[model samples]
Target: MGYLKNIAIAVLALSLFTFVVLFGQLPALRKTPLGTLQRALCLHLPNGLRSVDSRVTGGNITSKSRRLGQYLFYEQNPVVLILFLFLLTGSAALFLWNALHRLPMSLIVPLPIVLIPPYWFTYLCATDTDHYITPANHQDRLRDYPYDHVLFRPGAICKTCNLVKPARSKHCSLCGHCVAKCDHHCPWVNNCLGRGNYSFFLALLLTLGVLQLYGAYLSYWILKPYLVTDATRSLPWREYLPELGDAMVEAVNMGGLSIAGVGLLAASTAALPLGLFAYHCYLIWAGMTTNETQKWADWRDDIADGGVFKTSREALLSHSRPRSPEGANGAASTGLAVHLGVTEEEPQVRWPISSAQVIVRTNDGRPPRGQETLWTQIWSLSDVDNLYDLGGWDNLMEVLNGR
Candidate 1:
């Protein structure tokens, strides 16, 4: 009973941490109560502690911890990847050691099939470098996706990589390279999930969910007798509640942590990967990436501020490209900060849909200088076209094909 109580408490704590860590950065969730808590934990709390440390210890404590924090979190490291694999392997080993012998051959036969894919896919996701944009492949990366004229534009250059920021590409500071078709950097794999390995990341999520569910099932198989009672459906609600509680306690006492605890852990946490997979699926359907969603969210917020202007690409192309954005330093009036390339030209790309819509963010929440007639103020995301979305099926193929 004490062991069960401890396990419950541990899982509850872990669930909260996982919720904050995984869902904190999502644009939709950032304004929720969870988001507020996340900011307090990841931002305000750390700053307050660091400030106190600086006063008490002449910044010595925080200075050292900050460097360690930078290395562990801000830099590209295998700490998270190792921890994920270690936990995954340890949980499976613990569950199998206790429950495998009790499982039937029918159930035992599928274990290898279910178990091997997560490891294989994780290897693929972690090691893939084909998505990394280099001078040798810069032109090729550029031709993969056409600039949507809304979210992505030509002429933006990454100061670090000194490479033209390709449509749908993003520079990952941790990886120290621009990634083509960049979604988001995933610490769980210690790599950027982009063109080359995004499909494998999806596979890893799927196999991981399946593996957890199957492990939980095997544990259930071993503890089924203790988990059930002769109490009938005719039992009152109060009686049934007590019966169910008693049955679960008996099951835990019989199976201990290996069977009951791992089972509960696996069953409860299976939603994490599956829910993430579903979110990714929705992104594909909408023709966006995790990185792009953040960008689009900023645009939406700016539009709400009446700071976003739309025009035809032809109208903008008619005028000479400016060496720099007119109000580069002044784009702070809008709630969002816009990054526009200085004196960039649109590159020719092979794509089914070519968009002519162009959008610009102004520092004054007004139209660009001497171009009032050519611009139209916009207020909604539906007005924007996502050229990357070729419908859900095509988007999935694009990911699978690594394009």
Candidate 2:
């Protein structure tokens, strides 16, 4: 009973921690009560602790503590990856070992089949070198994606890499390099999911989700008979609540609790990856990346405040544009000035994919001046075009084909 209780407590605690850590900062949940609770717990609690430590140690201890925390979780460390591998392999091994006699060969055979793809993909994504955009290949990298003039505009430069930022490319601080079509850096794989490896990352999420759910089901199946048999005689319908509790206690005492606890843990943990996979699928359908979604949301907010205005893309491209200071090695000018709604006098480079509309921002909330093209007011996000969106099929194809 003591060991069972400890296992249950540990599983629940780990599940809660995993949930908060993974979904706490999600944009969709940011305004919800759960998000608020997460922020308070993850952000405010640590900040409050830092304040207390500052007063006690004159701020010396706070920075070190914060740095250590960042190094452990945020930086490209293998600690979380190792822990994830251990949890996955250990749990599967334990469950298979315990249930070997009871389970048929058919059930056991599929387990490894389902697990191998994600494991292989995770390794491939983690070690794949093609994702990294080096200064030497910066020119070729620029040709990958064109600035949509909405979420991504031309003329932006990666200060760290000192290269012209390609459309959809972003500098990953932890990786110390700009990644093309960059998604968020995943510490779980100890790698950045980008243009090169995003498909593998998605595949990893999908396969892992299936694996976790399958694990939970197998665990439940193994324990169900014991639980049912124990409950049948001891649990009475009249005192439903009390009898149910008694039945659970009896089952635990009879050694069914560990199996039940593991099932619950797997089910809870599976929710995270499944939810993330669903969200990413939606992003794919919408022809947006996770990074672009946040940018679009911000643009939506700016539109509501009347800070967003749009002009015809043809008008902007018709004029000559000078190369930005950052453009040295035949790189496009980093000063395209989407905010200005016009280009400076120089030769203009055509993007592979052209945006239908040129969207710009204003601080004073007034539309750009001196434009022959009609400056339409964007009241909502749907009014804008997602240049990246080739239909859903093509969008999915892009991911699968790693384009």
Candidate 3:
């Protein structure tokens, strides 16, 4: 029982740590206590360890570990995807093998329904390559989303891919290509969850949560005979708590490792996927990707420091620059130019909603030199426009259509 308690506590601690690691850097939580903890863990702790390692081992340990970390994270590998499948399938098999016979027909009938989608969706997410932006499809990908002139703007090219970065698209070093409508490269799927497979990723998260919850319910059902007692309710208020604890331990002991241990893990770690799904829902609602959220957070920080400036495209154009031919010059060449440091070829996207406002972040916390009259310091994000957000409903519909 003590060992079971220890396992539960360990599982819970791991789940919480995973939650903080995954969510702490998000724009919505980057300023919160969770963010502080994440900085301490991911940033401060690594730096401190490097310092110690430098002193003790002449940086050899740090070099080796850094290489390993880089390979694990930066290289395109199936390690995480394999590990995820192993854990998921192993746990489901353990739970069902032990708890299936004892459960009622109602529970037994729903097991396959609950369990199958994660595997199906995970395969879709993992094996999907259609989202990977290639030279062949690069031209078409450019028309995917209009530049917001904030997080993403015209004329930015991915040096690695040697191609113009489409709006809302990003080059993934691990994936070895630019991904269309890039959200983030998810290691769990060994793929970039973007235009083609992002919807599948969403379904995987939802179904994974349902599977874990169902497994947890089955565990509870199997142990119900032992957990239930007249004494649990009959006992006095103060005594009832301890009695409930004893009953839980007894139930766990009765179920043993296959049922109890797997169930504990399922219940404890269920929040990771479910919580991630909720966050993605928010992202869709706001019409931003995981990549865009971080970009927005950086913009938010710059705005806070008064380094960000805003102006209309018309105003910038009127103040300066002559237009070149549409094909030879980029989209911004007509609206902005060399003065703004963006003169590369941009996609001639036929977007429904065009953004007039252009934003820039200055290192000096002032407007560009000599263009002071045209620029205005933007103090709030509300003053800016998000071109992708056609309200939440439309955004959701676009996501549902796998756009």
Off by over 4 Å in 1: 1-13, 55-61, 231-235, 319-345
In model 1, the worst 10-residue window by lDDT is 329-338
Which scores higher on TM-score, 1 or 3? 3
lDDT of candidates 1 onward, in order: 0.82, 0.73, 0.82
Tell me how far the alpha carbon of residue 13 in candidate 1 is from the true structure, in angstroms, after superposition: 5.4
Name model 2 segments beyond 4 Å from true: 1-21, 135-137, 230-244, 253-258, 316-353, 369-374
TM-score on alpha carbons, each prediction: 0.88, 0.82, 0.91
Tens digit of per-residue lDDT, candidate 2, span 221-328: 766555555455565677655555555566545534356556666787887888889888998998888888789878977998997877665444443233523223
lDDT string for model 3 (1-403, tens) is 4655677688878987898888887777778999999999899999999999999999999999989878777888988889899999888888778777888788799878988899999999999899988899988888877777787866778999889888889899899988999999988888899998899999999999999888887888788887768989798879887777788889888999888878887888789889989989988998888888878878888899999988877666555544422223233444445534333333467566767778888899988766676689989888889888888998888888888
RMSD of 2: 5.8
Off by over 4 Å in 3: 1-8, 321-336, 339-350
lDDT of 3: 0.82
Summing lDDT over every window of 10 consecutive residues in candidate 3, give the lowest-scoring window.
324-333
* lDDT score for residue 174 of model 3: 90
Cα displacement (angstroms), candidate 1, residue 227, comes to: 1.4
Whole-structure CA lDDT of model 2: 0.73
